[model samples]
Target: MSKWTERMTDLIKSVGGFAKANKPVAEAFHTLETATRADGILDAKTHELIALAVAVTTRCDGCITAHAAAAKKAGASKAEISAALGTAIALNAGAAYVYSARALEAFEEL
Candidate 1:
């Protein structure tokens, strides 16, 4: 189910190989990820937590495992991770509720 964190180094090297094949775009994406993940206003743990939340919403198992590992390494507790996940869940639920209303209106129009 989850192999990303289990073999993160391999996955990263594989990405490098893929980027080499894809040329500029993939390489640029890697660079962008590096820049985005760098410690800025928020610490690494906070960033990783946010990334985990995004991973859940996107249904990316690899991302979930990877960011979670990173978050743990960055000193985030299980409770903090749970809280971040809760926010993602709440946001997704809220989005569904709002979109359901839109869908209903569209159905009425049709």
Candidate 2:
């Protein structure tokens, strides 16, 4: 198998193992999975897009890689993926700017 497929397989196995080993984590996963599967609020495709955005914003390389693949599998086009990544960058930039402003305010007070 290709490296990317191997990595994704490993991630799936790891998460499965974690769920089996930990009750609380398993419950949390179950709840979140259920919510994600729920009708109306967001479809599976949209959820994957949001996940891709979050993975990018948080700089989770493994997650970004996996979720991007998942997004594609869920039928996301290249343009959609690009737009999602752009949104992530914008949000991350805004968050950094806000944090820098807060730090500057604290420095002034000091």
Candidate 3:
């Protein structure tokens, strides 16, 4: 009913269609996902929080919705999520700063 819920529902359907059309690639991705999560170094909540932060940085709406729900299910609090997002914000700014230096170098050269 809500905007995010509707988007997630549609995303699920689309992913299903993609899997059906490309079973091998889908299965491979699933395998990779499972293998990564199989490592017990991080708990589910921490993993979901990291995934949500990466999703924000990558600008993936589907990933955001998926990881947001997963983070909630894993008992990540709102403040925890905000902290993860803060890391993402800092990372993006750092990336921009690095790229700005590169742009300046290019301008000097060209």
lDDT of all predictions: 0.87, 0.85, 0.97
Tell me each candidate's TM-score: 0.83, 0.85, 0.97
Ranking by TM-score: 3, 2, 1
Q: Which candidate leads the pack in TM-score?
A: 3
Who is ahead in lDDT, 2 or 3? Answer: 3
After superposition, the stretches of candidate 3 with alpha carbons farther than 4 Å from their true spots are: none
Clashes of each: 0, 0, 0
Write candidate 3's Cα lDDT for 9-107 as tens digits: 999999999999999999999999888788789999999999999999999999999999999999999999999999999999999999999999999
Identify the superior model by TM-score, candidate 1 or candidate 2: 2
lDDT of 1: 0.87
Output the number of the lDDT-best candidate: 3
Over the stretch 1-110, how does candidate 2's per-residue lDDT look in tens digits? Answer: 97878878888888788888997989987798677767768766788899999988887867876787879889999998899889989999999999999999999999
- How accurate locally is residue 43 in candidate 1, as Cα lDDT from 0 to 100? 83
